[model samples]
Every structure is written in structure tokens, then in C-alpha cells.
Target chain A: MKRLLLLLAFAGVVALMAWGFNQAIFVAPTEATMGDVQRIFYYHVPNAMLSFLFFAISFVASILFLAWKNSAPERAQAADAWALASAEVGVVFCSVVLITGPLWARPVWGIWWTWDARLTTTLILWLIYVSYLLLRRFAEGAQMQTLAAVLSIFGALDVPIVYMANRWWRTQHPAPVFGGGPDSGIKDPTMLAAFGWNVLAWAAWGLMLLAFRVHVERRQQRIRHHQTVAALAGK
Target chain B: MSGMNDNSGSQNSSSKNSSSKKSSLKNSRSLRIVVAVVVVLGTIGYLAYTGQASAKSYYVTIPEMQKMGAKAYSSNLRVEGFVKPETIQQDGPNVRFVLSEYESHNPKAQQNPRQITVDYRGSEPPPDTFKNDAQALAIGTWGQDGVFHATQLQAKCASKYAPAQGAATSGAKVATNEAPVVAHGNRTN
Candidate 1:
């Protein structure tokens, strides 16, 4: 029954994504300045948004891990597992944002990349999460969770900076479409609807990925515990 | 067998308790490391913040660039203006053009608006969108010799996306004929 539920969720995500893809290409009107290449905005913005959401989740989980470390070790372990899973999933989405951004910028800005405030901060955000994942992979035993949790907290500080980079500085990257000021915003209703659909679909998919990753981490912990017990018996 | 299982379970709990104590000790040491890491990251963040602030260049109009006078000549800057009709000259691999504060197509704005000569000698060729009356931004330093020696050039066609003036209901249609602007070069300011 659990397997069936997982399968159903997977199917739902695929269908939603397909609908989003159709909306982006066929339904949304082409942007005046960028034409069809602006279609990448549908995928790029949502990926960046979901990545930020996942990093925020990791930040909270890391705090919970540390807060519960002594009083509730089991709860702390669960929080640690959650932190790891969310950070990994966040990095995957961030990578997609980074890649799609350049593809869109190439035609619009005439350059593939720039060290503008927004772009540079986003790159740093990706790097910080990458470092968090490395700490989890190579660091040893109980100390590893503590160290990884600390890194997650540190890494998450970049999230707001990335979002505000464009607003605070003059950048080649366009201003925010939603809250950007008098000069900026989506003028077309269809464009807004398409962007909304894409964001919802991607967010749902990201949540599913996060849940599966957390489950996998818990199962690995159980297997490791069993091995430790067998080794103690032999000794 | 049940008794044996109970004995192992108790053994596991005791081991877990002892290990947890050990972990708490290690946690203190890890906390110190975390403090050190935070200090390093904080310093880096501070330096980056200041550096970006000092390096940021405002997008000034041609008139504003003149108002900047000698300061504009020294500092890195970006200026947006419309390309003057029939003023573009190809200089070997380089291109030179005149940028006006007002659109050349606007017959009523100013017959001869404030203009600046831009000599683009960057690594990449001028984008196909670089044509008469195109809105363009030049990123580089203004030479004392009076020309803006642009290391990078970006151009956007004016008629491409007619953004509705005041009416919230007016729809925008993408222009079909123009080639997409291509920005090339490693020069970033």
C-alpha cells in the first residue's frame, strides 16, 4: 500500500510538470524584449524559489538538531537526517537554476555570465550547500551530524542575500517581477498564471524528493545500527 | 529466544547512553570549530558586501555622464542611450558609434540631444541588434580624450516590446524580425 501511494504521488508530479511545460510553451504570451527565450523564466524562477524554500527547511532542521541533542537524542537524529536530505535536494534545484540562468542570459544580456551582485551571490549560495554536503559525506561519526548541522545554519545565511542582491544593487539581471518597484512587474495575466502553475508544480515535486531522501537516510541509519550490534556481539 | 532479545535490547540502550555522553563531549569541540568557521565566513561576507558596494556603477543618461565631468572619466560606469542614425563607423575589428540621450526617432524631443562617442574595442563583435536608434548601454571608463572606450556593448531594439504606457489592460506583443542580441566578452565591472 505504501509503495502504491508513492507510485501515485510520482505519477501526479510527472503530470503536473507536463502541464506546466505546456503552459509555458503554448499558453503564455512571448515577452516583447526576449521573445521565446523568456519561456525559460517559467522553470528558472520556480527552481530558485524552491531551492530557497528547501534551504530554509534545512536551516530549521539544523536548529532543531542542536536544540534536541542532549534532551532527546532520537529527535536530534531525526532532525539531522532531515537537514541532510533537504540540503541535498536544495542543491539539486539550485544547480538547475544556475544552469538555466546562463542559457537565458546569453541571448538577452549578450553574455553567458557576469559577476553582478545577484549572479555572484547565487553562485556563493550553491557553493555553500555543496560544502555542507561534503561535510556530511566525509566527516566521522556523532561529531559529523553536529558539524553538518552547523554548516547548514551558516549556509542558509546566503538565502536572503541571494534574493535581495538584485534589489540592493544595479545588476544586468532584471529586477523582481513580483515586488520590484514601480517600473517592474508582469503586465500579462497569462504570463502570471503560467509562472504560478510552474512554481506550484515544482514545489510539489521538490517536497516529494525531500520526503524520499529523508526516508532513505533513516533506513541507512537503521542498517548501520544493526551492523554495529552484530560487531559488538562478535567481540 | 525472547529473553535473549530482551538482553540485547538492554545492552543496546546502555551502549547508546554511553555513546551519547561521548558525543556531547565531541559536540563542545565541534562548537568551537563552528565558531571559527563563522568568524571566517563573516569576514568574507563583510569584505564581499563592501567590495560590491564600492564597485557598483549606476546606469547614467548621456546628460548625466557629462554632468559627472572628470569623475566620470576615471570611474567605471554604465551609460544607456539611443544610437544616432548614420553615425556608426566600423573600425577594423572594432566599432564606433554615437549615443544620444534622446531617441533619434523622436523628431520633437531634441534635434541634437547631448551625445557621446563610444569606441567599442572589446573581444566580441557588436551584437546584430546594434543598429540605428537601438537602445544601448556601454560599460567601461570614459577616456579623458572625450570618447567612451567601452569594453562591453549591449543593445536592445526599441520597438521589440511595446510596453503599454498607462493603460493596465494593453497587451504586449513580441517583435519577430530582429535577431536576439549577443553579448560577448569577459570584461565584467
Candidate 2:
């Protein structure tokens, strides 16, 4: 049953990824002027959004872990595992966002990068999560969890501020191209359909990765706790 | 007997809490050092990235450019203003014109726009029918010597190019026969 469940999950992820790839790079129409390369938006924007979301969740989970006053070693360990999963996924999504965003920007904005708020905040968000991972490696046990949680909260606070800074200052990054933004033209039906499907596919991909990472984290915690208990017994 | 059991339960809970606290603190000061370093390095790295970005030029409108004056406007610039109808002179391969400046925040000012001269040395401009009074952007440089040299020119194409929502239209390329206004000395090739 376990093997079957794993197989179904893997197949689902593969299907979602294939659909996402088509929506992102294949089926989307070429931009009128840029010609054939504007489809990178589907991957770049979604990954960027997901990276921010994972980090935000890490922050909330950390807060709950610290505040709930749970005394069981298992509870603390589970929270650490969640932190680990969030940090890993956050890093992956941030990397994808960084890479694909530059590819999209080069053709349209005519520069590989700008000092725009979204870009800057994203870089900061990436660093914050990298720090979370490094903190995990260097600090272990209860204190490590507490410190990571505090940092996660701090990092999440930066997201809104970063988004706001774009409007507060001059930005080179294009504003919303779809949705209800003031500059957004009406999206044609075909484009809208592609965008909707891509969003669903991306969500599936993110959830699949999150599930895998969380599973590994739980396993690691179990092993580590067993080792600690063995060591105490030996002493 | 009930009271005794309740007291023992309270003691067990208190002992568990103290034990967890003791375990957490018993981890050596080395853990504290690690946290400090990560926080410090993370903060420094984030600040450095933000600082480098802030030093780069942000996009500015033509009015913003005007406000920035000669000293502050140095990095690659994108200026949007109105095409000055009279200042537009098509000289051979180069077109020279002025962009009428306006506040960057006011898109409504596009209707009664001032003109700026753009000298584009590219292939022929998009089309002759392109409006003389349209909002435009000249993507290039404003020299320290105070002239703007444009490599590209774009006049915002309005709804005139397309048929309204449900109208059927046949495709036919129309000829645009505009008189050439070459500059006095540079009309070769």
C-alpha cells in the first residue's frame, strides 16, 4: 500500500510538471513585439510567489512551535522537520525564480537585472532562507529550533515591505501584466486558460516537493532522536 | 487518596518542564556563537545586496529626468515624453526631434503634450502615418554635451491598428508614400 501510494504521488507530480512545462514554455503565445520568448513569465512569477509562501509558512510554524510550550521531544523534532522542509523548498523555488526571472527580463526589459523592489526583496528572501539552512547545520537541539524560528519570522516580515517598496520608489520592472492592475489589458480567453492551468500545475509541483522534503525530514528526526536516546543510555 | 494523586501529577509536569529547560540550556555556548554568526552574516549579505541595487539607476520619466538635471542622470535612461510635431525632421537615416516633458505621474498629460527631439539612426521609422502628436519613448543617451542620440524610437500605437471587438477585416498592406526630408549634407546611401 505504501509503495502504491508513493507511485501514485510520483505519477501525479510528473503529470503536473509536464502540464506546467507546456503552459510555461510551449503553449503560451509569443509576445507581440518580443517574439517567442515571453512565456518564461509563467515559471518565473509562480516560483517567486511560491518561494515567498514557503518561507512565510516556515515563519508561522516556527512561531507555533515556540509558543505552544510543548515539552515532548517528538513535538520539537517534528517542528524542526517542518522547518527543514520549508527551508529546502524555499531555496529551490528562490533559485528557480532568480534564474528564470533574468531570462525573461533580458529580452523584455533589455537588461538582465534592475534595482527594482521585487528583485531586491527576492534576493534578500533567498539569503534569509540560506541562513536558515546554515543555522540548521550549525545549531541542533531545542535552541537551534528556537533561533531558526525567530529568524524565519524576521524574514517573513520583509516580504510585504519588499513588495511595497516597488511602488514607494521608481521601478524598472513591469507592473502586473494580467489581473486587475491599472495597466493590465484585458487577457484573451486562450491566454487566460493557459495561465489558470499553469497556476494549478505549479501548485501541484510545489505540494509534491514539499511532501517529499517533509517525509525525509521526519525520517531524519526519528534517526537523530534514536541516536540521542542511545547515547544517554550508554552514559 | 485523590488529593495525593493530583499532587503527584502536578510534580510530574513541573519536572518535565524543568528537565526540557535544563536540556536546552545545557548545550554548550558554541551553539550561541553559531547563531550569532549566521544572523550577522545574513544581515550583512542582505544589506550589501540591497545597497548595490540601490546604487543603480531606476527608471525615470521625462519630467523626472528634467528634474534630475545634468548631474544626477547618468546611468542608462528611458525617457517618455510627447513627440514635438514641428521639431521632427527626418534627415536621411537619422530622425531628429524633441520630447515635450511632463510629470512622470500624470499619464493624462499625454493629450496636450510638449515635444522632445529624437535623432534615430535606425532603419526607416515604423510608418509615416505614425502620429506626430503621440506619446513616445526614445531609448538611448543624453550626451554630456546636451544632445539626445536615439538608437530606437517607439510611438505608442493606439487602437487605430486593430478592428473593434467583433468586426471582420481583410488583410491588405497599404502603401505609405511619405516625402523624404533628408538633412542638408548627409543623404548618401
Candidate 3:
């Protein structure tokens, strides 16, 4: 039954993605200045949003893990697993944003990359999370979990900076589309609709991926516990 | 009775051993948490201080750049200004243009404005939005020959979004100047 549910969810995600792509390519009107290249915004913005969402989740999970460490070890362990899962998934989405951003910028901004505030802050955010993942891989034992949780808490400080970079400083990057004052929003209704569809699809897909990753992490922890028990019995 | 005492003694020793091991584990865990907290706090403090310092050196406007005088020539600066009308000369992928300190929405505002020449020899061709009276930000340093030698050029589309406060509104007229560049397509050199 669980397998059937998983398959159905996967199929739904695939269908939504296909429909979103259709809307982006056909239903949305071409931008006045950028024309076809502006279509990349549908994917790029959603990926960036999802990445931020995932990192936020990781931050909360890390806090919960630390808070529950002494009072309830089991809950702490669960939080630790969740933090790992979310960080890993966040990095994947962040990678998408980084890659697609340059592609869209090349034709529109006439450059593949620029060291503006927004771009630089985003790059730093990605590096911080990548280092978080590496810490988990290299560190061992319960200490590893504590160290990783600490790193995640520190890494999350970059998310707010990244989100506010464009607003706080002058950059070649475009200003925020959402809440960027009265003049900064999509004028076309169809483009907005396409953006809505793509954002929903990507968010759903990201949640599904997070769920699967957490499950795998739990299984690995159980396996490790079993191995320890077996070794102790042999001794 | 003796057997019973021996069994109880063994049980006491086993419990004591387990208790000691558990206490040691707890001690180490608490120690690790303290160290982790210190390291994390130190890192956050360092990053916050450095991030603030770097953010302070953000882009300067044309008037501000001139105010710095000799200091502007030494520091790598981003200068924001309006593209002077009819001053854009394109050669292959390289572009030479003039920037003015006028922030007016009117294209005629280019007349008699304080101007500076810019030579853009970046890897990418100028964007289609690059045109007369557009708002531009040039990232590079001032050269010895009284020109801004830009390593990067960015042209804002005025019609799509409102120009930032103090930036010229001439960007709105860029649509008319965009046709020729779109036909040529952006080239990277």
C-alpha cells in the first residue's frame, strides 16, 4: 500500500511538471524586452524559493535537535535525521537555482556571472550548506550530530542575507518580484499563472524528495544501531 | 545463602560499571556540545563583522565617484549613470559610450549634463537593452587617461520596471533603441 501511494505521488509530480512546462512555453506571453529567454524565470524563481524553504526547515530541525538532546534523546535523533535530509535537499535545489540563473542572465543581462550583492550572497549561502553536508560526512558518532546541528544553525543565518541582498544594495540582478514595492511585479496575468503552476509543482516535488530522504536516513540509523548491538554481543 | 550473596555481589558490580560508563558518556557529550557552541558562535561573529565591512563598499553614483577624485582611481568602483545620447559606438563585441549624471525621465536631459567616457571590453557583448539614455552601471576602475575602463556593463530596461530613485528614467525609451541590437544578437568575445 505504501509503495502504491509513493508511485501515485511520483506520477502526480511528473504530470504537474509537464503541465507547468507547457504553460511556461506556450500559455505565457513573451516578455516585452527579453522575449523567450525570460521563460527561464519560471524555473529559476521556484527553485530558489524551494531552496530557501528547505534551508529554513533545516534550521528549525537543528534547533529542535539541540533542545531535545538531554530530555529526550529519541526526539533529538529524529530532528537530527530531518536536519540532514532537508540540508541535502536544499543543496540540490540551490544548485538548480545557481545553474539556471547564469543561463537566463547570459542573454538578458549580457553576462553569465556578476559579483553583485545578491549573486555573491547566494553563492555564500550555497557554500555554507555544502560545508554543512561535508561536516556530516566526515564527523563520527553522536558528536557528529551535535556538530552538524551547530553548523546548520550558523549556516541558516545566510538565508536572510541572501533574500535581502538585492534590496539592501545595488546589483545588476533584478529587484524582488514579490513585495518589491508597487512597480515591481508581473504585468501579464498569464505569466503570473504560469509562475504559480511552476512554483506549486517544484514545491510539491521538493517535499516528496525530503520525505524519501528522511526515510532513508532513519533506515541507515537503524542499521547502524543493529551493527553496534551485534558487535557488543560478539564481544 | 552464600550462593545468593555471591549473585547479589555480581549484580551490584555490573550495575556500578554500567553507571560509570553512562556518566562518562554524558560528560563527553556535554563537553562536545560546549565546544560546538563556542565554535559556531565564533564563526557567526566573524562572518557578521566581515559581511558588514564588505557591504559598506557598495556601488557609488556618478556624482559620488567624482567626489572621491584620486581615491576613485585607486579603488575598484561601480559607477551608476545615464547613457549619454548618441554616444554609444559598438565595435565587434567592444562598446564605447558616454555616461552622464542626469537622472531625468526626459531623453533631452542628456543635453549639457556632466559626462564621462567608458570603454567596455568585457567577455560578453552589450545587452539588447543597451541604448541611448538608458540607466547604466559600469563596474571597473577609472583609468589614467580620464576614462572609466569598465570590465562589466549592465543596462536596465526602463519600460519593464521603474528606475531606482536618483537613476534616470531615460531607460523607459530603451525599447525604441532595442531593435537593432536584437537583430544582431548578443555575441560573446
| TM-scores for every predicted model | 0.76, 0.67, 0.77
Report the Cα lDDT for residue A113, model 2: 72
Q: At residue B62, give the lDDT of candidate 3.
A: 77
For residues A94-182, what per-residue lDDT tens digits would candidate 1 score against the true structure?
99999999987776667788777789889999999999998888876789888888789988988988888777766667778667765
Candidate 3's error at A60, in angstroms?
1.0
Please say which candidate is ahead in TM-score: 2 or 3: 3
Query: What local distance difference test score does each model get?
Result: 0.78, 0.61, 0.78
Better of 2 and 3 by DockQ: 3
Candidate closest to the true structure, highest TM-score: 3
Per-residue alpha-carbon lDDT of candidate 3 for residues B1-189, written as tens digits (9 for 90 to 100): 577556656777877577668868989988997897787677866766676666545577877888897898899988888787678899888899999887444455547666799999988778876776666878899988999999888775432422122212223234323332132111111
Candidate 2 off by > 4 Å: A69-73, A178-180, B1-57, B67-111, B118-146, B149-189
Give one clash count per candidate, in the order shown.
1, 12, 0
Q: In candidate 2, what are the lDDT values of residues A54-115, reduced to their tens digit?
A: 88778777766765536665675667667678778878988998898777665444456765
Residue-level lDDT tens digits of model 1 in B58-174: 477888789987799788888888788789998765889999887654664466688989999978777655666667889999998889999988764331221122211232233
lDDT over C-alpha atoms for residue B161 of model 1:
26
Off by over 4 Å in 3: B1-56, B73-75, B102-114, B121-124, B141-146, B156-189
Candidate 2 per-residue lDDT, tens place, B1-189, comes to: 577556656787877577657757856554896787688668856765675565334444665666677643475566666565466777775777767764233565456654345567777553332334444556677776566667766543221111112211211111012122211211111
- How well is each residue in A10-129 modelled by candidate 3, as lDDT tens digits? 999999999998877666655554656677888999999999999999999999998998899988888999999999999999999999999977766667888888898899989999
Could you give the candidate ranking by TM-score, starting with the highest?
3, 1, 2
